[model samples]
Structure formats: C-alpha cells, structure tokens
Target: MTLSDTNHAATLALRALAWTLGEPARAERFLALTGLSPDVLRASAGDPSTLAAAIGFLESHEPDLVACADAIGATPQDLAEARRRLDA
Candidate 1:
C-alpha cells in the first residue's frame, strides 16, 4: 500500500479495535506508536494499518487476537482461505 494508505489503514484498525475489544488502553498505545491522535482515528473509517497495528499490538499481548483475522469473527485459517480466494 501507499504511504497514505498505510497511515489510513493504521487509523482504521485502531478504531475497529477500540470498538470491537472495547480496550482503550490498547487503542491509546497504538495511537501513540503510530503518531495518531484521537481525532484522526475517528475520521478514518477503515484504514488497514490502523486495524493492523491494533491487531499487531493485541497479538503481542494476546495471541488469540489472531482469531479475528476476518472482519466478522473469522479465524486465522479463515483469513488464509479468504486470501486464497482473493488470489484465485
């Protein structure tokens, strides 16, 4: 992804994580790591990086975060399957 896209992703991921896990501590740490403010996170709806960083952070703390590879409760294998489908 482009630099802007990466930043945008980072923004969205955080929002999803904040909403999904209801973990403000994780979200705040992600914001700090990515140099994003609360306003920016609110503005970007679904940037991959935002989601990615949040997941990444959570994964470090709790590997089960891998279970959410898909947007709607997809497992890690499901994510691989989705990728396979996309690449086909």
Candidate 2:
C-alpha cells in the first residue's frame, strides 16, 4: 500500500483532490463538506493542510476513497498513509 510508484504523498493528495474536483458535483460536495472555497483551494493546494484535507475528503467515504485510489493507481491505504504523513 505504499505510494512508491507515485510522487510524494503531498503531490498524490493534490492528485486525489483534482480527481475529486474533476466533476462539478463532486467539487461542490467537497466544498460543502470541507468549507473550502475555490479561491482557497487554488491558493493552498500545495500546503500540507490542504493536501491532508483532500485526502481526508477521499477517506471519509468508501466509494470516493476506492474510486480515487483507483483513479490515481494507488491503494486506499496509500492515500490514508499519505494524509497521515502530510499532517505529521
């Protein structure tokens, strides 16, 4: 479940965020749940906090987590570990 095949965890988190936000509905849902505005997302996409939030967004729901993991060619655990590392 390592992210050895991908970029660093922070980068992977951003990739997951982009995947979650690719659909307007999904993006809107993420914003609603996380209280993050598009401006803020754009501004802090590189921050550890933002990356952690994005991974948390994916981790909150099984369907989204699995889908995001698959989309990014990673396992769900990898994303979770990535989040933990970023937060630490």
Candidate 3:
C-alpha cells in the first residue's frame, strides 16, 4: 500500500481503537504527543501531524493501549479493500 493508504489506515485504526477503549482523552492525548490533532483520526482523514500524535499516544500508553489496537487489527485488510473500492 502507498504511504497515504497506510496513513489513512492508521487513522482509521486509531479511531476504531478510541471507540473500543472508550477513551477519547487517551486518543486525544496520543495525538497531541505526536503534535497531531484528534480531528483527523478518521480514515485518510487527517494531517500527518495527527497520525504522528496518535502514534505518540499509543507509544506512551503501551500495553494498556493494546486492547484498542487489537480490536481494529482484524479489519485492516478489509479496510484496505474498502479503500480500493472507493478508489475504483
């Protein structure tokens, strides 16, 4: 996948995680650490900073954050296919 696709996927993953964890604050904090904004957590939805912020947040949260990550892990390929459909 292209960088943009990866970034978008990451954003979607982040959103899925936040939803599962029920901790928007954690998600927001994660984005903030990477100097990212929470608004962009949507798929292909936000700026690079937002993605970076989320990564930073997840890094800080560690094992506690794994639950959220795992929740979305199952859907990445499916998400990619959806993106492809959108592109087509």
**What's each prediction's TM-score?**
0.45, 0.90, 0.44
Q: Candidate 3 on 11-54: residue-level lDDT in tens?
A: 66446445533776655555555453444445434444443344
- Top candidate, metric TM-score: 2
Q: Rate the local accuracy (lDDT) of all candidates.
A: 0.51, 0.88, 0.48
lDDT of 2 at 36: 92
Top lDDT model: 2
* Model 2 TM-score, all chains together: 0.90
> Per-residue lDDT of 1-88 in model 1, one digit per residue for the tens?
3555444444444434654446566556767776778888666535544555455554554444464444444455443333333223
Question: Cα RMSD to native, each candidate?
Answer: 7.3, 3.2, 7.2
Write model 2 residue lDDT over 1-88, tens digit each, in one string: 3455334887789889999999999999999999999998899889888899989988888899999999999999989988988887
In model 3, the clashing pairs are 30-53, 30-57, 31-53, 34-53, 36-49
TM-score of 3: 0.44
